[model samples]
Target chain A: MPDPTSSPTLTVDSAAPNPAPNPAPNEASNETLGRFNFLAVIGRIILAFFQQVGRLSMFTASAVSHCVRPPFFPRQLLGQMVEIGYYSLPVVGLTTIFSGMVLALQSYTGFARFSAEGAVATVVVISITRELGPVLAGLMVAGRVGAAMAAEVGTMRVTEQIDALTTLSTNPMKYLVVPRLVAACLMLPCLVLVGDVIGVYGGYLIGVNKLDFNAASYIQNTWDYLETLDVVSGLVKAAVFGFLIALMGCYMGYNSRGGAQGVGVSVRNAVVSASILILISNYMITELFFAQ
Target chain B: MSASPPKIALSGVKKRFGRKVVLDGIDLEVAPRESVVIIGGSGTGKSVTLKCVLGLLKPDAGSIKVDGEEVVGLGDRARERINTKFGMLFQSAALFDSLTVWENVAFGLIQGHKMARRKAREKAIEKLAQVGLGADVADLSPSELSGGMQKRVGLARAIADDPEIIFFDEPTTGLDPIMADVINDLIVKCVKEVGATALSITHDIASARKIGDRIAMLYHGKLIWVGPAATVLDSGNPYVDQFVHGRADGPIQMELRG
Candidate 1:
């Protein structure tokens, strides 16, 4: 089976211009290819990339501005909160739990060779809280919430419901986009916090039962080494990831054109963009918080 | 005193998507409480014209005036103010599936006008009744309704605010002939009862005759012929004749692409 996580990116990239543009027939006929045409194609690709970045940045700025503006929709925001946060908890929790368990087992085996098996609990707790919990939760939510937001909004766009909202004297940005952004930003941190606890507990389960470590000592070691900054940084990363996820989904959906195929492309784009941004920003945020 | 300005007017309007020009310079006017229908083949920019007037799509050039106020390039706040005076019934009814029939109808009142929910519900039921829908239909989701019923609910929502102007986009495009006539009749009744100026776009000649006071034919991005609805058959414009009589052979040729 195709990996569900990377499938969206594959579809979106297929829709985009071929990464290696096919050689033109006339150019292929010429043994010595003209350098200018190749440069022109490269230049066009670079320009298109920058153009898309500019558009997305503007959309993000507008959505963020609307999040702080008046005429807020508390009910809509709450509805999105439930959708993004409550509905995503199980998947995030399961992923983090397995990840923590596996990390503990791998670290225990490595540390056993060095006669340092006691470090397994500390390693699991630190990794889960500092990096894995937020990153995993972010990716999972991007798959679930981001894809759903894009599909729903994209369908609304194609069906003229967004235009209908405009004609009804409601700003589509404020009515649709802002609530999702606010909900994601506020809720992702909460999800990361919960996932962090569940993940540490998962490590504890493996350390105590599967690995012949004392339960109390494992718990004590986890608490002794995991610092407050670790959790705080992870939550911070979660917030940024949440914002980008919601922004990409809304931007792709709002600009969706054509019809059903357009909506499918948008759904794929939302998941792909959100996943890449989550990974990139995770590193940047970690550097910001921990780099010397 | 200067004569009151047309309820809505467009002059020298132009819109092009990429290289294809959908609307070339176009001019038209709808006097107060006048029902004007623009007839055109699919893809001839009838919807684009409505979108431009509704500020959903911005024209590339020229002026669009609503109640004598130039709306082109207006900011969101100004556009919102302009939209409050208008309502639209989309071709698909475009009801919010997330909201019930009553909530959809009361959306503008509650969200835009900030009316109390209880009062808005009462008014929504009243409007639904006006469209011949019973109170029981108010709480059901729009998805549960049949196409004709959805169109009725759409009409009810469009007139809920008693807007000064209402737009009906392809009001009968997908309906059976009988249902289309019913919708057309409701449109006429609602527009007349609300005393709202009406602007509609459709290819249905029977609907055009029933709902429009004046009919204009759009061909090749321009209003090729415009006159009273009764005189459409006698307009003497070949394009109008070809379209009205549904002739396969005409001066207007379809752009067939392989």
Candidate 2:
């Protein structure tokens, strides 16, 4: 006798012919199909958006929480800052400085055609402070620091060093994400500040030395055309872009899959995502500040 | 000898990823200062089992006790405290490329435990030597080392903290056979020297036999057979025999992609 509590067993009948319920099984599949028909599309999009937003906010929060905690690896932070902020100086400075000089020459040429050569200072300062400094800094950082962060952490993730960190009682977020995020947040603004000065200085150098403009008059005019909001707003944008760049770096790196292929993909994604996010955020902030 | 509780124990641990079941249910135990090697083929959830114990992957339902303390659902702080007693050598030699070999070895000691740099440096150098690497290699970046040397450095780092529980995941993979044997020997010597409970997972049967006092074979997310290393060949289980012989014509089928 079969016990009442016994589990059901599948019995195979060698001699019996089983009938195929084609229509019934097909109808079951049809019901399964209907369940996913309209809901799938809308649910997928919503899930995707929420997932993106969740990841972004989670990255931001993980970074912020680690910023104020102990087990502070000052050496790692300072090294990252130097690597990210200071080492980036030459590239950002050169890009903006040349841009400033080019802007001056271009402005002179354009304004000269219109018989408005005196407007060069206004153009240079407004363009450099309002647009070039933050954007150029963001792009350079996306290329340099963002790619490095992705590659380094992606390799770690693939190789399971991140796992090792957790096993060792060290939080990978605290150790990896925090220092980078904090360094970027703290350093990017400073780098942008430096980039602003250098870019404006480049404009001055070209305006006076190459463009035959009077130095005192150029400086005075450049200063006169500047509003506090322009500088403050650019700095604000730098801060936001800084956070985005680092967040993208950490996110892509942390979530990297596959192996060597995955690390390469992560690096590419980090740069692309960070650059796009920076531009989008820059526009949003600009609109917020000057949306008259 | 009077018993202190087992160093590590898992009671019917199970883990699943979506529809794919990684570990169905696992029951394991590692006594203090004992070396247990888990042998399994790829995709047999060997790594998953190790990760469940490491707390990297949370099991769906079951208890994992380390030092007789329940760790399955511990909070972050408690988890961190528990993790301090564990060290792991990953499948790949996952040394920090940015840091020198010595610094990589000293990472947990300095970063996690707040050991002073000088002392940590000294300990790191000593650990490196214990792994048969010279002091000169200590100052060089991990990127500069060969795969075998990196594995040694990884091993050094794993034991640098002298953790009570050490997990080695595919420790001998990606190395020359001789170098693999060398690593296996070093792992045995190191684990023995520290008296640390060693739990390892590998597909390498040779490595399993070499390092394990007791060996368990995982098949279909379950431990099919466990016995002393000397008796593994004669375990009398068809699955274990099929696996140990590396045969394709057994219960495990080879999927031919046409």
Candidate 3:
């Protein structure tokens, strides 16, 4: 007799084949169907990606055109500048200072192995002005301001306030998106500039107090090594990152559907996409400035 | 008496999203100074009709003429010019939360017409009084008001610019019975006061009777019956009779999924 363990398996096999009603003939067809489905899913994903990219480019073009057009709202623009730039100072300041101190410490530790600890000041200034200052500030604002913009605009979309604006003969694009875009693009560079100063100061404090360096020479090294090109490239990157962050935030919020859950999705998407765009664009900008 | 062109008209209008059709060949007209209310259940395209006429939506196929001028695909500046003659009250009141009550009311005036702030404020306060709201509430945010009060403020805003046409979207949707009647009265008073041609969409029979001069019943994306509001209860049409009575067993079957 067949082994007892094999009995259940034998019975299941018999039952499965009978229920399928000619499974042998359909197996190849089923495999083909599954392969077709897999290909279809991938095709749909690629199409959706390109569709989103196209829509985003169109939105950016319209927003830029509106910025240059007439009928601007000065009060709205001013209020946004205060909110985006001035109110973000404390958080941005804290981030850059801590980053500067840590960079100084780590660079000194690494260079001391080669008896090159004197290079700490140059490293700190260069890193802060070229990369750390703008990147850190952008990531922080993406978390703070980008999420807030998404939530606010998403709520307006769901509640029909944006439609109400249209009914009132006001263009929502001109009134809402234009002001935020202009404000973010203009104000982020200024924030990065301030952050650069605060960051270098933090590095200086650490060099004098913790590392037993001469304050005068530390200052001299920082000022002497700093180049105008480094600062200008970073500021330009900050402006581009600002535009990307605001555009992504506004785009997500403007297209959000449903209710509270929709608003939540928009907020999460705004932060995640803004952060990713900031990092990706950071590389491209650095490559542009540094590549031979 | 001569036959004048309708202030608003829709002929063979159709709109669909993907495979689902929301409006299929809708034809309607609202004469100048007339209040026409369309009644239908959820997803029956009542709001879509109003939006089409307002140029907030573009129908897939049809003609929407306001005063003999086709508005189906007008440019932005032309649309804005046409929209100056229109005002709308949303289902949710939809006041701007960022602004105070007076600012919300004066928004169309200040932003659209470029009115002076002082003059707009005075006009907003005056409109507020017309809707039974006091000047004390003008500085408060929209969140602080009761639903009824917010509705009143919305009405004040809609008429503040003296628009020639007004659209009310579910004017009495989320209110107590007494407050609903009060809003009805205010709508009648406001429409008469502003002398605006009105178009509204709602499912409340009582509201339809009170605010609508002519009642049209929309079913499956088509207006099945249009008649005087006073005769709505006895229209004798199966769909109209079934809907006005709110009966479950009727020719218009509710799509229930098990």
Candidate 4:
């Protein structure tokens, strides 16, 4: 359980030359400076959160707006779809398959004493759809897409390409974030659905070959026990997880403060935060759905 | 518009990060097409001052007006409107490594203006030519070029949009003396050709005199002196004298944390 909130601890040399950025100019009164600092820190924290949310909101809005605009970058969108969605398939697929296999194995040992071995199919399908498919997919995408997004945008930010975009009268949020977010929002459900199928198939293999269950019976039992709500809930969770992963990636990259060190921190923070937020949000969504 | 305004103006602009005050109170103005170079040592609020006017950093106090519109606390739409009129050449010649030379140069034209790729590529090539690069180099990535060439690409990118205001932040910091002079010449020529208002911050006195119509010295978060570039040698300010001479011993002390 890697806590996302844990700050990276590095033993930097005290003598390392800090960018002793000069103090602000004199117009701020002593009173104003005090208030400004207090507010700025609080504002920065709020702003950091807002910048991500705002960027996400603005990105989504602009993307939707662009859907109706004349000069749509369909080529760029297609390229991003490949980069962000299609290319990410193998990693998500493999992780889901393995998770399903392991979950089936673990659940069987626990459920064996109760002689409820038939419940393995139901447990696997329900758990995979409700939690594992979305959560594991979220974490996998965090490691894959989240880090990649952070590094790509983080580099652009530090290198001033983002500023260059600004100078050219382009909204970076619309240009950079929108395509990625759109791709993630649209594709994660597809990925999770694929993941759900693969995961269930994996559970079936383990149940039949390893645990000596009948193959026909396992597949039939998986479908029999799975409600439409279960699959729909996973798809819904996938969409939220997708938004969070892309949001955190864009957020950390957009606000990358320091130079090289800042970019590294951004990548790490993006992946860690997205993964944590996914699980936390998953639990909340689950609680909400089942509470009644 | 009711009478054309000054190109850019900042009056008593102040910004601070925690206990660290980056810009005390910067009051400066750039008339249309004028070139102003700010000279200061490292860690002096030179870059922060530029950032404030660029609307990248909001000031704690004071007014920043570009073409007579107060920009200090403007919203994103307003800020983007102001930003579109400006271009910046960063200290490191921060060209996008992932993009080809032409694509990097044409990024603004394409992404910002939504220009067609063909027209933007043509425009990018034209800009590259202005900076002494050939069409052959346009398709190559920025990383393939040397430091000087990369700086040229940066200069090309800066002017590609033909912005009304251009900022050069330590444009010659890492270049050799000859290369630095070449960059200075390119900057002067390009700024003149574009007839854009130029505001540059640098410690290089030679570069300052070469590229500036006027030179201002920032020390202790204040503009200690601002005058015509020709008169910088005789500014009669000790801090300016110490800085311009690059003396080992001066009022500016190296901070040794206790």
CAPRI category for model 3: medium
Candidate 2 vs. true structure, TM-score: 0.89
Candidate 4, fnat value? 0.68
> Which window of ten consecutive residues has the lowest lDDT sum in model 3 chain B?
B249-258
Q: Each candidate: what lDDT? A: 0.93, 0.88, 0.92, 0.86
Model 3, range B201-247, lDDT digits (tens) per residue? Answer: 99999999999999999998899999999999999999999999998
- Sorted into a CAPRI-style docking class, model 4 comes out as acceptable
> In angstroms, how far off is A36's CA in candidate 2?
8.2
Backbone clashes for every candidate come to: 0, 0, 0, 13
- lDDT of model 2, residue A99: 89
Model 3, residue B88: what's the lDDT? 89
For model 1 chain B, the run of ten residues with the poorest summed lDDT = B1-10
RMSD of 2: 8.3
| lDDT by residue (tens digit), candidate 1, B1-258 | 127679999999999999899999999999999999999998899999999999999999999999999999999889999999998999999999999999999999998899999999999999998888999999999999999999999999999999999999999989999999999989999999999999999999999999999999998899999899999988899999999999989998987841
lDDT of 2 by residue, A162-182 (tens): 887888788888889888888
Pick the lDDT winner: 1
By TM-score, the better pick of 1 and 2 is 1
Candidate 4 local distance difference test against the native: 0.86
Q: Which ten residues in a row have the lowest lDDT in candidate 2 chain B?
A: B249-258
